[model samples]
Target: YNKYFSLGISVADEMFGLLFFVLMAHTAYGDVSYSFLEEMKRGSVIGNIAKDLVLDVNRLSSRKARIDTEGNRKRYCDINLNTGELTVAERIDREEICEKKSSCVINQELVLENPLGLHRVIFNIEDINDNSPQFKQSVIKFEIRESALKGSRYLLDEAHDADISMNAVQSYMLQENEHFLLRVLTRTNGRTYGELVLNKELDREQQKEVTLILTAVDGGTPPRSGTVAIHVTVLDANDNAPLILPSCLIPGCVHIGYNITITATDEGSPPLSSTKNIHLTVADVNDNPPVFQEQSYRAHVQENNKPGSSICSVSATDPDWRQNGTVV
Candidate 1:
């Protein structure tokens, strides 16, 4: 009698186990996706997973429904079996997870036991403006020649933002100045950079150095910005010619064949000068008249001498040069 009773109990247990296996095998699978803003606080409700997956809310606890992140060390989310709502288990930082990727997604599964059921749950993480643009260096220095052309371009270091898409550095601004302007450029990889363009020519004589502020801005609401000081030292160029001024000098005596040197200097910071040698020559003028040694000429000649014969000659002197001193 005891052996027969034990056999009946074993058959009943096997039949119940077979029925449970058949019920688990008929479980349905589902796929659903939802979006949520990143940096949500812990315990924040994402959505009612039971309603989205078309599951009976009353049976959530009975079926032992839970969220499975596929062996992820950090459980980002959890399912409230009593309320049928999915809540955040840990704060999700989009930058920490996706790291510059345009799209951020956390793949999870809604798992149920007893009569096992599986549902794929995808969570799309959206970005927020929590980061500001930052430059590697606080001050950037440049040495530009004063002779640079108006359209010359100089590449600048781009600002870095941890946030992706619109929250990243979007544009650059240059302070109002006469010599330089700002131009924004895009890269093939969808990153943006800045270019300092020479909108006006530079003159080291006028301005030896220039200080400008460069600002990088993000496309967030009430956008955040970063600033870098640009210290540009205008290098001197030989663009200016030397200027010579006219002047008169009163000297006691000046020789007819004197050499004079003239120098011209420019208005550069380190002034430049040029020298020229000039040979002076006196010109003939009618300012002096012939005069005798004794103020009167004395000539002794024979009355019967020939017209071209020799006679006692009278000489005169003039303190003039060249043709003006000729005593003919």
Candidate 2:
């Protein structure tokens, strides 16, 4: 028995052009599925099988049935006189996807049957980025330690001004470090830094200091420049000791506890002159024999029967400077 279903229609340029009729059924056991009896085929006609039935002329049958002939075995559906239902011979939606103009289907309108159902199908498309990275500010500056080695990583004060996707921001470039020895360290948020690490350590005696410049770039379709200047100041290490100058300028004139002025200076940056203004204290040494104030003194100790008893103590003082003045 044929069952009635819904219809779908679409129009273009203010005229109805596309129409689809879908048919679904409840079998004898009450299970809902589509029927495959009648479909769109050539020469198949959708007319009332029972002519004397009391149904409306145009409402009796939907022309969605199968054409049933040997050479013209196209599918078409006939109008149900009792139920006003359409019967399809093949799958409804797959048969009616025509891209041409003025194309029509006889019984293939079942494609739009479940257009609003949750089981409807759809397609999605995606887009990509193609723009290169640039710098927000033309120039940026940061400090670098002169002691930093070539190829050592120095963080940038500015970051790239583009979205961080492979198509948008491809890779990074450096204007300097041409030896291909420089390396880059990137942060999680796309910030980048370069290293000028040392191929060999520097000697303070040969070259006291130096300076360097740095720049950054990104890899895109058309690359962008993000250049920055790095100012590095190499400081001197205290490798040289203080040297005493004009050793013989004073001759045996120092007295006990008298502070003498001896000059000592280091041959380094700033103030290469001798450290003459600095005073050096001189203490009297044991050059002369120790003279007793009272010639000699006598001490008496009583004999003790018990052990661990103190007998007598004496002390002396020397008027010298540094470690020499104190005795252990």
- Predicted model with the maximum TM-score: 1
lDDT (Cα, tens digit) per residue for candidate 1, span 48-85: 98888888888998898887775564678888877788
Relative to the true structure, how large is the alpha-carbon lDDT of every model?
0.83, 0.38
Q: Report the Cα lDDT for candidate 1.
A: 0.83
Q: Least lDDT summed over 10 consecutive residues: which range in candidate 2?
A: 117-126
- Cα lDDT tens digits, model 2, 192-301, are 65554445545556654444445555554455544454444445655555766644433343643544565566656543434444344443444443334555667676
Candidate 2 deviant stretches above 4 angstroms: 1-153, 167-181, 186-193, 200-211, 242-328
Off by over 4 Å in 1: 1-27, 240-259, 264-328
Clash pairs, model 1 backbone: none
